[model samples]
Target: MSLTLSLQRSLQQTPARTATIFGTRRRSFREHGDRVARLAAALRSQGLQANDRVGILAHNSDRFLECIMGVWWAGGVLNPVNIRWSVPEIVYSLDDCDTRILIVDKAFAALAPRIGATARHAPLFVYADDGAAPPGMLSFEDLMEQHEPVEDAGRSGNDLACIMYTGGTTGHPKGVMQSHMNLWSAATMRLSETPILRGSTSLHVVPLFHIAGLGRVVMQSIAGECQAVLPGFDAGAVLEIIERERITDTVMVPTMIQAVLNHPDFDQRDLSSWRRLGYGASPSASVMVEQAVQKLPNVELSHAYGLTEACPVISSSGPAHHSEDARKSGLSRSAGHPAFGVLVRIVDAGGREVPRGVVGEITARGPNIMLGYWNKPEETAKALRDGWLFTGDGGYLDADGNLFIVDRIKDMIVSGGENIYSAEVENAIAQHPAVAMCAVIGIPHEKWGEAVHAVVVCKPGAELDEEAVRTHCRERIAGYKCPKTVAFRDALPLSSAGKILKRDLREPFWAHRGSA
Candidate 1:
């Protein structure tokens, strides 16, 4: 069945059950279903048609969740704008996908005019804030009040569900086309592997724009579980919610988990209701994992590894892998075996499967694999070959089938749950008039797992400093994509072919890092 059908099924079976909680706002399944239907009707009233793209630029809230369901319900594709991206990045995605309608919250209201000015086809702005609509924007509540509930559009199977834009190696963003079946399969496969607990109440603090966060939402909906969403992450706030709301399940990146654990009130909170803690987007430090195990001994920990193109669940290391014996055996560091219904292989450049324990590019074939890259025939051909989605990740699988990540073949850095491509950062840095050349690389970071670091060679007699280079990048890209550390260099190490040798550049910083 489709995502729309799943929501309807929840409404039919658990109409009176609490569906969502955002701050003091609580919605029962029946109320949420009615709201979703009205929102779908509202979208149609605002010129949305079958397969039209609708954008949402907001923080994690119940309204954000509603917008996601509403898009699918109205037979429109979703383009959830990355909350951390700069205005230019957001506008690029909207323009690239030709999104015609955008929903903005109070947090992003100021960016609405800029986006409208830059986008080729200015989107109809709908303010998702609880208060009155801002100037030149339609009120979300008003639309709901004016429109009557509408029937589901009944789109399912291979129909496009979302166009998730991911960082590109070519210094641009590529929209990964996720079909309804892809997302459905991903959520089902994950549930098969790790069944959801009955009466589960999940805390959603991770940004819904990311695959990890959206995947959780889909999974929770399928299971008819209640979700309590936070607008953004705050360590103390999460602890308080877990205690007060009796949150049982939640997903977070390692950096966020570390921050929560480091908070002074962590031990003072009553977190006994937190039964499951899923972490991903980057590997967790062994020290942090150990501390979590020590402090929250009863909580089951899991880690997943996937890319947006895979509809995001390729493999998951479950609680068993986080056990003391498994940790001692170093299995906790593995990305784990392929998820149910997913086939994973390590293949060489020619697409031939490699021998076990041999490092090669990770390739996956599954119903969860994305349709293709939007408006990028060349990239689609390159990534999807012979029915296999070639993930540009360097990894090896042991005889026991546990996947061990070695490095990134595409030079992508995941810092604080955000993907930052070296090419993007380098492109921004090179735009500085004083910069002659620059290469960006991922370096080990204690809190973020990996940080974007840049090594630059300035032009002769050109005055440039680390702050100058960083400031220039911030103006071009998101702050998170900017290099956290800058090192000036006379020249970069190059291969015989005149190509920059990134391995050589990364060696010094990662030389001491032991196998995870």
Candidate 2:
């Protein structure tokens, strides 16, 4: 079955159920289906071909979900533009993908003309805001109003469902191809019929452009549950929505969760409806995890581990994963076992599986694995081989099979011919009293191949001295693993998912040097 079939199934099973809640607006499955069918017919009559990429450049709304279903119903692939990107960045993505249509909303209506200017192929532009089709633009409602509610396009499994553009940390963003089956499998990994997930009203604050946000959409659509979507994450806004909507389950990266927990109105908001809170992106600190559990004892904590290429859900530590021993013994740092239907193994450079508990590249094999990079055969070849996607992550599995991801493969610092995993050093530094967050990178040195350098964001009202940090690490890790130079910042640049943008951190220092 395809994503289209799933949507059709939900529409048939629960016609009256509230499918989407965007601010005060709500749409039931039956209503959503009708709108989507009309829009799909509109798109098809406008010459939208099977697998042609249609772009969406806006925030969360009922219209966002509508556009998604409309695209699938019309047998088109989705190319969601990054909201954080600059005009040129967005333009570059649209140009690179050759997207023939763009669906935008009221929030980004101003940038519509600008995005249109740089689009090389000059695709059709549709506004989700007003039915009025602007000069040189098509109206979203016009599509729905014009087309007939015909049968589904019947795009089957393995068909290109989306071309998700990865934010270019190194350079231009590249589209990652994902099939309907790939996404379906990833959804099963978390929101399956497990008693832990059923009957939960999922809150979506993350932007739809990112995999994590889209991941929430996947879960909600399959489970046939209600989604309370916030246009963008505002601390007060999120808190108010939770209490007002009686949201039951939500997922976010640690950064957003930290902000929500630190919000002044957090206690004032009635969050008793929340039962399970899933956090990921960057691993949570022991202290932060402890505080969350203490503050929200009624909520079960789950963590997911995934990259954009993996249909984004690789493995998850579910509600049942939390244990008193794990919290006390600090074993909660582990990312937990491989996701169901996903085969994970640590492999060496030659693609041979390494011994358990050995640090090597993480490889994942599943239907959830992405088809490949869009239109780039060589790059696709590098990623997908023998049905195994070689994930460029450095991690290990314990004898008990709990996988622990340390850092990116490129982030490992090789100094004096010894491999020093940056995450190990960063974790050590993070444990210091003064360090709020830290990223360790290698800097060129004449004597060693690279020297361990620490860029730390110090905690509020705390003083961090290089000597104190170095001394603290010497006690816990190898002496050579300690940072030779510590640089202080108010905060480290992070991705929307809260993962430290190590490439951004390292580029300033290493860009002029010969090697990474």
Candidate 3:
């Protein structure tokens, strides 16, 4: 079913029920529906057509949710830009996907001019905050005020729904094209296995740009539940909202979960309303998992494993896998079994299935798999082979079919729930004049799950320091993607073909620890 159908269903069945809550502002299903319809009309007035790409660069808010539904209702494809990206990176995504309209929240309003100047298509900007619109931009509130509610476009099935830009292995971003069917299938599969009770309140702490966060929004909409949103994740704020909203369910990365557990007010807050806590985007250390189980005995712990290409979920491990007995059997560490309606396999380099218990490249196939990468035919073909999406991850399955992730074949570093491509970081570092060669790897981190570490060889007689390399990288990439530590190396380990052997760089940090 189309995503718009979810809102329609809620409006018909629970029109008077709360639909969104942000700070003191609240909207019922009826009010939300009217606003979404008006937003669609506003979009159409700006020449938005069927399948047009629309971008939103903003923090989590009720308005962001409105933009999502409004875009779809306007028959436009959703292009949720990464909020952490650098200006150039953001421009690349907008240009790459030809997003014609961009919705900017107050936090990102200052960057609109730079983005407009750099982006090839030069998107029309819509200020989505409560304040007055800046010059050359249309006020989001004004648009809704001026336009009349419009009809749904009724697009469904394989129609392109989203073009989510993910970090590429080649020093750029690639747009993952997800169809309406892909998102609906993934959401339904997740809900079928772990159903949401009607009227249950879900707290949205994660950023709306990520697939996990965005997918949960869709799932909540389909379930016709109230969603309490936070502008961003803050340990104290999250706890306060959970108690105030009487939130029943929420999802976060392991890093976020750890932050909440460590918050001084975590125990003082009235958190009895919480029932389910979902964590993923990176593997959880056994110690952390045990702590969560002991500290939140009444709460159900769920783990999901997937990438953007799978519409972000290939498998999930529910509370059963987080039990004490399961932890003793080491099953708690597993990524869990293949999700319902999804088929997963462990394969060798030749694409042949490997024996059980052997680590190999993970592959998945399902109705929820992404349509393909936008504007990259060769890359898309490489990823999707013979109807199977090759997930660049090393994993194994036990005889009982428990999936365990061992390593990241793509050398991707997930820090604070954000994917940082080594190639992208390396390219940024190599541009520094003093750097002759560089390699980036994810080292063990106590707080962020994995820290981006860089190994660099300076030009002969040239000088550089850790901070210098980090500062240089910061100017080019996001602050989080910059190397937390930089080691000056005489040379990076190289293979016979002169390719940098990153395994050697990661060996020292991960020698006694499990792969993150």
Candidate 4:
């Protein structure tokens, strides 16, 4: 079914129930359904064609949800822009995807001029806000404010739904084309993986541009749950909302998690309503996960493993496993079993099956798999060959069929011809009490072809120096894998999804040095 149907089904069954709570704007299922129907009709009038891309350059807001359903209703696809992207990056995405309609919220209205100028290629532009629209722009409210409810766009199953653009870390970012059914399948199945997100009031703290954020919206809608949105993530602001709204579930990356945990009022806050802490985009540190369980007591920690290409979910580590084996390390280290209705395989370089416990590329195949990259046929073939999505990640399955992500073979650093997995080095570096976060990458070396370089963030009040961190790694990992050079930073670069952008972190240093 189309994700739009999820909302329609919910609204039809529970018209009086709250569909979404947008701060002061309470939208009951009946209210939202009428507006969604109207907006869909209006968009159809504006000439939106089936499978056309409609870009939303907004943060979390009621209009964002409205646009999502409206686009599907109008027989178009939603291309939610990453709110954190620079204006130029936004331009690239809208242009690359050939978006016909651009939706801008008040927060990014000022940027509309530049974005509009660059997006002259688009056919239409609309501004969304409770207030007035910028000059030369159409009003989002007017389009839906008075129109009548209409029929569904009738696009579902393999019909294109959304094109989530990845952060352009390597070269230009490519769009991962997800179909309506592909995402819906991932969403409904995810409830089985993360039950707390079902029939619960969720907060969109993560940027809507990401798979995690968008997937949550569809899943919650299917379960007929209420969603409350925050424009963007702010630690103190999040804590205040959690307490005030009695938020039951939300997904966050490790950085956001750390920010909230370190908030001065964290311990004293009455955040007892939170039911689930869904974390992904990167591995959650064992210490932080353990501490959160002890401190929150009420919240469950669940981990998901996937990429944009997999419609973003392949496996999940939930609270049941957390209670059984995570007090120490065994299950905590695993990224849970393959997700429901999903198949995972670890294969060697030759595409042959590898024995359990031997690290190999983790590949997946299922209904949730993305069709292909928007226009990169070669890369698409490389990724989706043999009916399996070959994720570049390196890991292995255990005797009990639990997967343990040992390292990223694609992200491996080679120094003096010796291979080093960044996760291995980062894990050891995280052990140092003075370190907050770290990223290890291969830097150009005149003789060794490439050398290990460390980019690190130190804990507040800690004075750990570069040499000291090098010594720590040297003592734990292979001596050659230790950083030959270290750069200290207050924070590392992260993608909107909260994964460390190693490509972004490595670009400047290697701009003129090597092909890294």
* Shift in Å, residue 46, candidate 4: 0.5
| Backbone atom clashes (below 3 Å) for every candidate | 0, 0, 0, 0
After superposition, the stretches of candidate 2 with alpha carbons farther than 4 Å from their true spots are 130-134, 193-196, 514-516
| Candidate number achieving the greatest lDDT relative to the actual structure | 3
lDDT value for model 1: 0.87
The TM-score obtained by model 4 is 0.94
Q: Candidate 2 at residue 313, lDDT?
A: 77
lDDT of 1 at 490: 88
Global lDDT of each model? 0.87, 0.82, 0.87, 0.82
Worst 10 residues of 3 by lDDT: 492-501
Model 4 per-residue lDDT tens digits across residues 1-516 = 777778778877889988887777888988888888888888778777888889998878887888888888888988988888898888888888888788888888888778777764843778888877778888988877667788887788899999999876567888899998789888877877555445578888888778888888888888888988887888998898888888898888877887888899897778878988888766536656766777778888888888888878899888876774565546776788998989999999998989998888999999999999898899799989889999889988999888777566757776777767777777778778888888888877789977888888988899888889988887888787788898999988776566788877878878886565
Instruction: List runs of model 1 lying over 4 Å from the truth.
Output: 411-516
Model 3 lDDT per residue over 1-516, tens place: 798999999989989999999999999999999999999999999999999999999989999999999999999999998887789989999989888999998889999999988888789999999879999899999999999999999889999999998854355888999999999999999999999966699988877888888899999999999999999888899989999999999988755676688688988998888899988765524545766787888899999998889888899999999888998898887889999999999999999999999878999999999999999999899999999999888888999999988657768788999877675687678767787667789998899989999998886789999999988888988998999998998877753212356766787788799542
Candidate 1 on 17-90: residue-level lDDT in tens? 99999999999999999999999999999889999999999888898989999999999999988876788888
